[model samples]
Target: MRKIPNNGNLKMTKVAYPMGLFVCLFIYIAYIKWHWASATQAFFSITEAAAGARRGQQAQGPLGTTAHGHKVFYGIMFDAGSTGTRVHVFQFTWQPGETPTLTHETFKALQPGLSAYADDVEKSTPGIQELLDVAKQDIPFDFWKATPLVLKATAGLRLLPGEKAQNLLQKVKEVFKASPFLVGDDCVSIMNGTDEGISAWITVNFLIGSLKTAGSSSVGMLDLGGGSTQITFLPRVQGTLQTSPPGYLTSLQIFNRTYKLYSYSYLGLGLMSARLAILGGVEGKPAEDGKELVSPCLSPSFKGEWEHAEITYRISGQKAAVNLHQLCASRVSEILQNKVHRTEEVKDVDFYAFSYYYDLAANVGFIDAEKGGSLVVGDFEIAAKYVCRTVENQPQSNPFMCMDLTYISLLLQNFGFPENKVLKLTRKIDSVETSWALGAIFHYIDSLNRQKSWAT
Candidate 1:
């Protein structure tokens, strides 16, 4: 029958105890995911798992137009890669910070990249339209007009001759103009290797919150694209920047801060392009009189047709070779000599390797094929040696495997990474896809903000 007064602290403990436990559990799980996820699914799933209320993804400036009771935005990015063309439709929600957070993304890819249509730009229209339709379906009809659509062609386009590359861009622009979404003349264009590498670095650092803090150490980025490869990282030592050649150092402004980084894109030295070069096949030039090109890198008994930039060449291994790896290493050394700038600082810095680098490491059993993992620089060499030696005895296997692995190993070594150097090979970091597309969107939004601020 008697009522006792409630002890505020005692009662608060009851509520806070469960709440604190929940927060702790959540943080623990997030830490596991951020540090220990093994591999990743296809592009679609990574974006689906993105947490809502992301930082810096807020409404109006760049993400998208708002609707009833919801802050929704959209950005369409098309990656015109060498092997394929991919479209990324990103949706974001307004968050508490100056930046907005990503909620979900729609991704789709088609084979035989844009470069394949260099001779017939019209053929690229259908694929581009299909990708555009994906954006149309994901974004609400009302937001289409306000949504910004952009397409950035990678090494595939850059590797093409100037006029031909322009033709592809013109065709893409025509396609974008016909679309219902927002369009701009500057939307469709080729992305140089340097931008590709730097953008990827931004995506990684931003996702990991490295750039959000002052004086936070940032990881380096290694992107092995189709026709080119890029390496970008913030150097701890100023000497790294001072000793760099012209155009290797890039200055970037992000979150109101300027960062000077060591970045370089090696044109015509991507895995596939390097393969062509190492095989003694000239880019944009077929063998003389339709003759097959023979090289020491391939198995002596093997011969096949190799397709690159829309040209198919008959290729075979040299018959005079003994010790395939040694010969192949010598050839790869020649291909990479004076081609990629070797940096001693990278030997001590952490790196995130992606694209073909991840694929090759995964396929060779160095890391999880889906849930990627860390690998030593020696893993590539080991795989290359084994694959090359294996192909020599069994010449019926895929020929490029040896060359690709060998090239990756040679490329890393050329970058001054020791055999035991550890590199993180990943597909997704913190549920966001690890690609330049995300960074491209961020840059677009920043430019929009800068323009608006300037006008005011």
Candidate 2:
């Protein structure tokens, strides 16, 4: 390079170097400022990527609204049942009062076919896919990475043909990634639907001595489903309170306290009604003729056990009377003699009053009667009260497996229970969030990130 000229006796000019560097530094800082800004702060950043973040902040569109009053999390949940599939979608959020309480955006039922093992998994996939697509369209917001679809299978899955079950699950997994959870509806219902969240937590705490499980020491919970029923129990805990919510304002809970509990999933409560229809002895019987069969106590004044009984029933949408007391006595007698569980342990437990109709009745919808004059069977919510003489006679037993699956163990762990001690509680809430599935999916997705992990 040829020197243009010796300026001021070869003194170097600072302008060229400093001026160029200043321009470069200005550009570099601008770039860093733009790209380094957090997604939450992208609006203030001047980078192109920051602009991309700002796109998520566009003012409420003509027909759309922000979920967090900012961004939204749209998610899917399925109540897979034997008779049909119920799908629900929601925008997960915890900004209470900021957004409308979740209403079922979409409730769809897909009926493929009837079999213990569903042979129509392939056929059902399209319905589910359609439902999913509709869910995306209905959510109104596009940000949903935080809320993944929660897929659960209730009792119907067991009846599904093995190949069909595997294929359906595989398809769901492929479509939803590791986010799909195939769980029992009973599990999902209690976790999400009833006051079961508090109930489960209370029971778990009572068992560990962190809370009290006392009183009649007879804690029980009954959850009825379309295909089955679950009964759980531990020691009952009683407390006296003057102020509480409307229902508990002056109420008694059966399983007020928790203990090492037991949970039994019966495959035949609601399904049995439908299944019995196929049996000749149960459904093929002749209808009652006009000739009345009168006995010595048929008179109104009769005081016999089965006589002078009045039954309240609805037929063809009309409420009518039948011999309910007789019907109840007969039903009770059958249950007392029937073998629900074969194990000596289960068989030995005292027969508490039947919480058949009321216990968890709402989980499943009302059962309908058949055309052949079949008895309309619904899950009766009843709480049985009985002395456990036979159970006491047997050897002491450990808690049931279902009790080990509760969220209490995790809460206890968070509460400083050693891992060993926590494990003793026999439950590990599936990844804090899993414990809250379809029923609580929205709530958990909205709150999980904010919750401090126990270990942390």
In candidate 1, what residue range of length 10 has the lowest lDDT sum? 42-51
The per-model lDDT (C-alpha) reads 0.82, 0.34
RMSD of 1: 16.9
* Residues 140-183 of candidate 2: C-alpha lDDT, one tens digit per residue: 33333333466666555654446766666665555555323322
- Predicted structure 2, TM vs. truth: 0.45
Name the top TM-score candidate. Answer: 1
Q: Give the poorly placed runs of model 2, Cα more than 4 Å off.
A: 1-19, 31-72, 96-104, 113-117, 161-163, 175-222, 231-264, 273-456
Error of 1 at 294 (Å): 0.8
Q: After superposition, how far is residue 407 of candidate 1 from its true place, in Å?
A: 1.4
| Candidate 1 TM-score versus the reference | 0.84
| TM per candidate | 0.84, 0.45
